[model samples]
Target: MSFKQPLKAGAVIATLDVGSSKIACFIAQMTDDEGGFEIVGVGHQASQGVKSGIIIDINLAESAIAHSVHAAEKMASRVIKGYPLRDVVLAVPATSSESHFVDAHVQMMRQNVTENDVRRALAKAQVKAQKEDREIVHTIPVDYVLDGHRGIQNPYGMSGQLMDIDIHMLDADFAHLKHISQCTEQNHLDIVSLCSSPYAAGLSTLVDDEIELGSIVIDMGAGVTSYAVFQSGRLLFAGGVPVGGQHITSDIAHGLTTSLADAERLKTLYGSALATISDEHEYIDVPMVGEQNARGEQHVTRALLINIIQARLEEIFEMVRQGLEDSGVEASICRRVVLTGGASLMPSIPELAQKILGKQVRCAQTLKVKGLPDATSGPAFAVSMGLISYYTQRPYEMPMEIASYGESKSFAERFKGWFKENW
Candidate 1:
């Protein structure tokens, strides 16, 4: 299931996001308008068996997925009863993700280029992207070269003897992906496509200008902080650090001698990535770890909590900076950075990220999608919304390796007039 069937009116799409802190599921159906969709159901459960995007306890992970999917199904039933939730698009973390630029050249068969020519070049690179242990997540075209001249956007109508394409290849760890597959298959759901969470986040968060001009998207999940780079209206790279919001909560638990639950509550209620002098005077109740509920309560300044949160977030941003430098993308391409996901909800996250990374930073949520409740429209559901958006994109084909199943048939039916004219 490398490429999904192109979306059309009445086609249903379901997505699952397995994160370190939570597991979420969304069900949506394509609208009559082209590239328009509306969310019909949403459900997210606290993650139980997954740690750092790896499944440790198979049973626990399966159970969590089951509950999440069930809730989403229940909600969707109101709109369309008996909607089958069998196939789904999966969102995986960007841990161990890799990116590359490969060139594919093809000599034109006819005087005027055709869409088939472009597909052939992309298919050629798709063949080259076939690896032994890595699973391809995205194969995107960045540029077009025609007749030895670069920067050709569309060479279809012009005369060109030879054409080449610059393709961006993205892949992820096979073992990590397999584990999630096994767990999902156990829940009776077939995996149709797997997308890196950061790439998915970029689709839902970046506006048209950001996607066209160039920008970076950072998704601060519970277990991993993943990033994606976009330039000239294409995805350039994706990578991640092993630290995220979960670590900050852990730090708070250790520093303040509180339970993980209470630490999470504190982080949600009063956490800040940037601490201020006023925080020293603000006091909050901290329940002791060993003592009983009422007797063990103690008053501590919010400054201590902010310090712990700020220190850990700084390290995360530092690692993200090092990652971008190692990615080999030019600093000029990433004019601004956008933050999303669960952790980006903290106060002053944009300020802290800007200070540490030395780039313009802002927090973002899922943009332009409809029917998502307030709970699922925020930064936390960026990846979930992204999977829905990914469903609407034109599916790239790797003809030599993977077969074109439903997508080919659907395309033919949808464009029968053009096919008849060309043939």
Candidate 2:
């Protein structure tokens, strides 16, 4: 394996995960040495600023962001009074995001892979990707193919007559980008870099072997079901459907004739993705909104509740299966699917996902971090924890070669800044 130099350490890095259910803030200190980062602080608040999967209420979302960040800063015992924590690694949901795999091959000027050649090949991919209405947010190298032999992660230091690249390029609608930037600017926070939420979660939850052997990480978040297909330690494809755990709650509420809050409470306490009639022992209780009996008691049967929850979960898994099929990376996903995110915590989700996708499924959690309490380090916190890994694993050096090749930095830089600063 080739070693890329690590980013500067000792600096405080914060990550913002704005999702349908909540906005989470994570702050960590990168160690100067090669050890992974330490979680110095964390914060989370119920999200009121988003709907389905996109940011719809800017002011509310901004307030949520500010509150979460402030809590994190306070917990870390640091006063972020200056600059308002200008730099952040912001996680963008796939709601308004687009991803396409693009390849570029460049004839080698010499028999060796120089940094210049790699830069030119990547730039070619980015230019080709940004040719139309969308702007490229990330151009990550999927793999490097030198001559006839493939499977090269880093072609530099290897001898090759030509350098070929497979890149996963992420883009967003121009309007979405502008709106996000304006929203952050209004709050005096600049985004440093924008990372796809699914991709980031995959980085932390997926093991090296899983990526090499081909695996799918499915993030069953509140407002969206996001997925990433990984192979050879790179993201091959990522997409998100509009359905998520929230939809399940809504389905239960509608199907059971219950209030939203009651639906949510039932989902958390009694939801099951794979329920059999035999599992029903007794009737469960679901309170009626603004209506109570003489003893203030209301109840529903467990089997009825499970039926509603299971139907919704099955639909979600089917949607995930369709998303994997749409990615068209490989058929290997049939054997490997890792379930994550808040919804995955449901007791029967793993078995249900396995049955639906015909894959071995398990809930994923962040590993190789210290001082993370168990309560906050499960699949539910996968995205927030994964952001820490993303910040630590990213190469520190600027893509100077891409700049020297006469590539315009205004759009990419501004977009990257928005990602880096807003977290």
Among the numbered candidates, top lDDT falls to 1
Cα lDDT of candidate 2 equals 0.73
TM-score, cand. 1 vs. native: 0.89
- Over the stretch 51-74, how does candidate 2's per-residue lDDT look in tens digits? 755778888887877787777766
Per-residue lDDT of model 1, residues 247-277, tens digit only? 9988999999888889999999998988889
lDDT of 1: 0.80
Cα RMSD for predicted model 2:
3.2
Position 217, candidate 2: lDDT: 90
Alpha carbon lDDT at 185, candidate 2: 66
| Alpha carbon deviation, residue 120, candidate 1 (Å) | 1.6
> In model 1, which regions exceed 4 Å deviation?
1-5, 293-295, 366-368, 397-423
